[model samples]
Target chain A: MLYELWILAISSLVAATCGIVGTFLVLRRIAMVADAISHTVLLGIVGAFLVSQTLEGPLMLIGAAVVGLATTYFIQVLDNAGVPADAAIGVVFTSLFSVGVILVSLYARDVHLDVDHVLMGDISFAPFHTIEWNGIPMGPQAFWVILAVFIIDLALILLLYKEFKITSFDPALAAALGIPVTLIHYLLMTMVSITAVASFDAVGAILVVALLIVPPATAYLLTEKLSRMIIVSALTGVAAAVTGYYTAKYFNVSIAGCIASAAGALFLIAFLFSPSQGILLRGRQRKKAAAPASS
Target chain B: MQEWLQFLSSPNLQWVMAGAALLGLASGVVGSFVLLRKESLVGDAMAHAALPGICLGFLVFGRETLALMGGAALTGLLAVYAIRAVHSQSKIKQDAAIGIVLSVFFGFGIVLLTMITNGSYSQSSGIDEFIFGQAASLVGADVQILIASALVLLILSFLFFKELKLLIFDPLFAGGIGLPIRFLNALLSSMVVLVVITGIQTVGVILMAALLITPAVTARYWTDRLGVMAVLSGLIGGLSGAVGALLSSTISGLPTGPVIVVTATAFFLISFLFAPQRGILFRMMETRKNTQFVLNNFLLDTMYEKLEKRYAAGQYSALFSRRELEEQTRLPRNGLEKTIQALQKQGLLTQTDGKYVLTGTGLAYAYDSSLLRRIQDIHLTHEAELGSWKEASANGDLRKPRDYLMNERIHSLLTAEQKLPVSLAIKQSSIEYADQA
Candidate 1:
């Protein structure tokens, strides 16, 4: 039970952090870029491990952040060079991801860098890897890493709320006002990379995309204001985490997959039932408007 | 070489190779329309969305490949519809909708896959193969399925070639022309879904998108004509599949799907750099030539204008010393010498006693008031445009200039300093154009 609680805490923290960053990404219409970043960060992790010769180090996050930024830079270059947006993303991420896969298969086969684990992380065992502070147990290491990322993300978002808002809404205006829009954009991407890497060992690389995109998308469907959207997105993510924990327990399946599925299900519910944008509600509204005209 | 021939002659390897080639051809043909429609990643989303259907097929009707494909097709179509619905009904854009649907469906599929892995179903052992694919596992029966689907896709695409082209390039115009645009769009999407289904078993869910899109994009670099692009794309995709299969078979531990993706990407990289017109190398060369041509023209125009001014000042002699020409045109000596030589070679100028004289043709070219008038007209129009833009900017209307002034002639006539504003205006206008579209 204690193990289950730890897993829940870790997964919720992971989902909430992704949710907070993802609201900005979805608003900027670059959630898919976040997906690209998540995939390419795998190459960074492998490179870091190859260089540092250890899986447990801060260098992995730094390496992954650098590669993630490189992916964005390459995507922008390709976009400017006349490749279509979607195709450029597809090309860069897949190529980088394939290189990462090949590298792991060839060189890191003897280490903990298993491609399968990179694809589908083993969150169930995360509780066993406890972190210690001066020889005192501090719960699971995964939990602490995610908590630190969540706090950092929350603090940054709070500090840079107005800047993020102005830049995402109208970058030209933000630039006209000397907001350093490009720097903030890179900072957001770096935060996304850090959050993705922090949660990678718990939710896997690909599923990290799910946690990043789905909850925020769901929250967008539910609310109009950014503040409400962030709060709602975080809540949805936490809800999915808790519900998915039980779902995985009952079904004896992957906890991470279950959480992603739960987040998806919540999005569907909001898509159908949200008061302002719900499909059925809008249909009824249309009918009512037509009925008065007909009468 | 003998061993390679023997390996190629092997029956099972032959079946896998044939399946891959057919799948590649079908995907390429369909992917042309997908690319033109600017929905390249829609194929990616559909491919990922097929995962849940495969698992549902296994859970419902056991592990028959056909049944799984049928299930995949159904769910893939559903996902496409869901994307469209979300985009049309909500404030979310198409790309966001695609990302949302893709991750969600694939996530659900992962959940189901986990259930299968933990369950007691005996046939579930090979189900995970759908994720990364196991092309070497193809048998005679699977090859038949691939062939039938590929042939159907080819025939349908051929029959609807003109319609697909019209729809892809201009759906709104096609609809205005009463072309059943929605039905045509649905058909093309279904074809993409079918291609994804057939490809998943070979290239897997994630990398199937590379097979579908990379070939079409690669072929786009080789030709301007759509028909030629489609055929070349199919050929390129087929070649990549065959070569990838052969290479994977020769290698010890390489996964076939990644090998295939890498092979296709290699083709893309080569085409990107080396293809005839659209390749980077050709574009760079064209840009260099254009810049040189523009510089030469600027020098010639300046010289002509100076000559006209001298003539207006009552100088009758057509010949002028190089130093006089340089002083009048304010040109560097080396550039003036080169331009004079080039004009002389073109029979527009002649050298006499260290002086440059205009030939009859050169006189006609220099006195061509139409060219002068055109340049003046361009300058006047640009000044007018600049005035309006300044007024608009002052009025706090931040909208950029529209695309009415992107003429290459105007671009060449502008000086280096003038080109910056023109290019910036073009960029802003093009962005606005894309946004409106």
Candidate 2:
């Protein structure tokens, strides 16, 4: 039971990191990039496994970053060369992801890199593979790695506080002020790629893609500042992960789907009931304001 | 390639191609308004939000087919109405509103999918495919449904094009002209919902949204005229759908959605590079020519200055060695030498014994009054140039909007209540322009 709690904590922390980075990605209208990166990482993972003859953490990260950066570079190149933003994204991400799918089939058949794990992740069964550290049980390989990543991301985001704010708000203005807008965008893309690949092992590919965008976007509804948005998104991500986990167990369904659905459901509730902005509440407020004027 | 092309030319592939073409044409036509209004992602939300409708239809009939589509379209229309109403009554931004509706509605869909999968439903596995399409699985009935939907959409678009254009181009003028912007918005959103529902089978909900936006965006590079843009967008989309279907069928293990999207991107790349006025190749060539011309004139001026200094020194020599000229003028060896040779042949300079000197005409051209005019013609960002009237802010101040517009010269063009915001409040304001603008 205690071990199960540790697993939950480990899972939540991993989700929180994705949520944190995804906030700015969605705000920058690059939500699709996050989607593209998550999908493209499969190719990277497969490629790394084929080359390195092992699935070590750093090798996967390097492979994923290379593919992810290539995805971003190719996309910007397409757009710069004349492709529409949406179409360029679709083209570059799709092509790379297709290559990834092909590679997965050709190699790594022995590994559990099958469609099911690719879709929903293997967290429920992740606890079975435990490692011992300092003669104490470390539940899964994902636990320590995810926790470290979460802390690193939290610190890095805090460190670059002002620069992220300016760039996310208005990149053109930031550029005019000589804020190294290109470098910042690339850094953000790199961070998105790292977080995406990390979360992929815990929450499956598509669910991670959906969660990264959905939770952060939901947080944006409740806050104006980027700082507040990051905090709110992390909270929403952790909440959604826990709710999704237990609910999936209770109902005996896909945990990734439940987590994604829970995040979506939370946003819906926020949509209907959020003060000042929610659909129903805003309609009522509009009426209340109009009543005095009509009289 | 031959075998692939042969497979592509088959009757089944042809049907799928035809359906995709018609669907593409409809989206391009409808999506023109969506993009122009910068409400593009409204399609994304509508697609996600339509899932519950399919489930409801499934719940009613216990299967997945055309009926589920109608149910989804209806629910999609409802979601659009909700989006419109929320924006109208509240201060929530469009993107946030889209995100909210998209997530919540999709949340409901997940819950429904769970129930349906848990129960006895053959369509469960196939239905998930609607989130990521399989173009190969397109059957005759599906093609007919798509064609019918496309026709219906086309007819509605034609009936409402003028009104839709008016609303998108100028909402206030449209309202003042009594074109019913609200109803027109609903009409367009309904059209969007209809297109998305039909597209789900071929491109899934997520990728369907991409198809809706991608072709239209690609079309934008080809033409600025709304009508032409819509037509081009349709052709690109149709070609993408066909080519994507072909590519996926030929390849052993390619997903249809990604293939279609990649094909659409190919069209975009072609348009971006080859389209007249906007192509990067044309722009680069034009810029290079302008730069070379500037370099040429600067070379001529430097030559004339050397002549003037020599003339001041009472020297009559019309020739100087390459070594002396190289010291006199700082330019790269090969290109400069080539330009000098070219200029000498053009009578702008005289090359005698590998030395070049300015001609009488070249000397006059160096001090020509029209040089500034020629430079100005090629000056990019001339408006923002240094020492311009705008930079110094010391001109007639015609740049100021209030001084120019409401300063009695255009008073006769306005009615009594027209200039209220300008004079009474003295407010500096602008409508938050859409992202497309």
Candidate 3:
């Protein structure tokens, strides 16, 4: 029961962190870059492991962040050179990921890291990797790490709320007003990288992308206001984490996988039933509008 | 040498090589259309979404390749449908929709994979090979299936080539022509799914997209025609596949999928840097040449304008110093010197001591160019009734405008309307204005 609580806390924190940063990504229409980053960060993890001979410190986060930014940079370069955006993203991420896989197969074969672990991270083991604070168990290390990330992200968003909002809504206006659009973009990308790194330990790499994209996308259908959207996105992510945990327990399957699946389910529900943007609701409204027009 | 010989003769390795090459060829042809339609990542999502279908196929039918591929095709098409539904039905964009479908379906597949792994299924051991793709595990039956699928895909693509091209390039027009746009779209989507199904066992889900994307993209750097691009992409993909298979076999612990991706990326880098027209290096050279050409033209125009007054004064051999030309044009000193040297080399200008003058050929060239410039000015100033000036301006050579809008008739029309001032008078006034400034 205690371990389950820790798992819940860790995974929920992971989802919430991902949702907060992912809202910006989805809004910016760069959600696939989130997918690219999640995959290439495996290379970062492997590279960091080789250098530090460990995977437990800030180095891993830094490595993932560096590679995440590099992924964006490469994609931008290709985009500037007239490569289609999808092809640019597809080629860059897949090539980088292949390199990462090759590196893992070659050098880090004996280590705890492997491609499968990177893909489907074992979140059930999160509770066992606890941290010690002055001879006291301070819960799972992943929980603290995710909490710190969540707090830092929230604070950053709070501080730069106006800048982020302007950039997201109207970048040209933001640039006209002398806001550093590129700086904000990379800053958000860095935040996403950190959040992805933090979440991947709990939900694995690919599912971290699900957490990043699905909840925010679902919330986008529900609300028009940015603040409400963020709150709703985080709540949706948390709800998925809880329900996904219980569902995984019921089915005796992978928890991270179930969490992502649950997030998808929530998105489907909002897609069909949201008051403002749901397909069914909009269809009914359109029909009523058309009825008056016919009279 | 010994290992190479053995690898070539080995039947199993030959099957693996053939399988990978066919997979690459089929995907390359199909992927060209996908890339052109801007649905590259949609292919990626479908590839990832195939996992759960493979798992379900395993659970239901138990290790039958045909059943597994059938399930994969169903689910892959479903993923495409889901992406379209999400994108059209909500405010969500296509990229986000693709990301959602990709990760969620993949996540559910992982859950199923875990269930199968922990279950009492006997043959569940080899199934995980579909993740990273163990080429060594590919048997003869798999190779034959891969070959057959590749042929079917190739033939379908060929038969529907025109329809698919129209759909990709101009779908609205295709629909207007009553070409069953939606059916063609579904056909393309199914082709993508078929490619993904055949490729999943070779390249795996995670990197299967590379086989579809890289070669097509690389071929794009080399050509603009869709037919040629499709062929080139297929050839490049096939070559990369064969090379990747051979290299992976030689190197222990190297997976065939990543090796193939790396090989395709290498091809992409090569084309990116060295293709004839679109390559980065070629573009850079073209830019440099364009800059030099523009500088040369500027130098010639400046020299002719300066020497025109002296020529009008009947001192046709008159000269101006490099410093005067530099001050007049305000071009960078180094560029000015290079342009001057190039003009001299082309026999467009003559240099005596430290001064320069336009030769006879150069004077004639500059006069035509200057006349074109003045006529353009007149056309712009009198915007109405000068629509023909745009066609004249489209002429590259100053002499060619005479065939369009610069003939004596148009010149007389302009002069009668007082739009074309006396050429000598205009130059004299501009010189006077220059002196005053």
* lDDT of prediction 1: 0.82
Model 3: lDDT equals 0.87
Computed on alpha carbons, the lDDT of every model, listed in order, comes to 0.82, 0.70, 0.87
| Distance from true location, Cα of A89 in model 3, Å | 0.7
lDDT of 3 by residue, B1-437 (tens): 99778769898889888888888899999999999999999999999999999999999999888888888888899999999998888889999999999999998898899899989997888787788777766778888888888899999999999999999999999999999988999999999999999999988988899999999999999899999999999999998898899898888999899999999999999999899999999999999989988887787767666666564565534467777887989988888889888888888877666667666566556655655666777667766765655564566434554443445545765544232223533454454344434
DockQ of the candidate models in sequence:
0.56, 0.30, 0.90
Give the Å error, residue A54, model 3.
1.6
**Worst 10 contiguous positions by lDDT, candidate 1 chain A:** A98-107
**Residue B254 lDDT in candidate 1:** 71
- Ranking the candidates on TM-score from highest down gives 3, 1, 2
Clashing pairs in 2: none
| Tens-digit lDDT track of model 1 for B195-265 | 99999999889888887788988888878889998898888888888888878788766777777778888
Report the candidate with higher DockQ, 1 versus 3: 3
> DockQ (C-alpha) of model 1?
0.56
Worst 10 residues of 3 chain B by lDDT: B416-425
The top-ranked prediction according to lDDT is 3
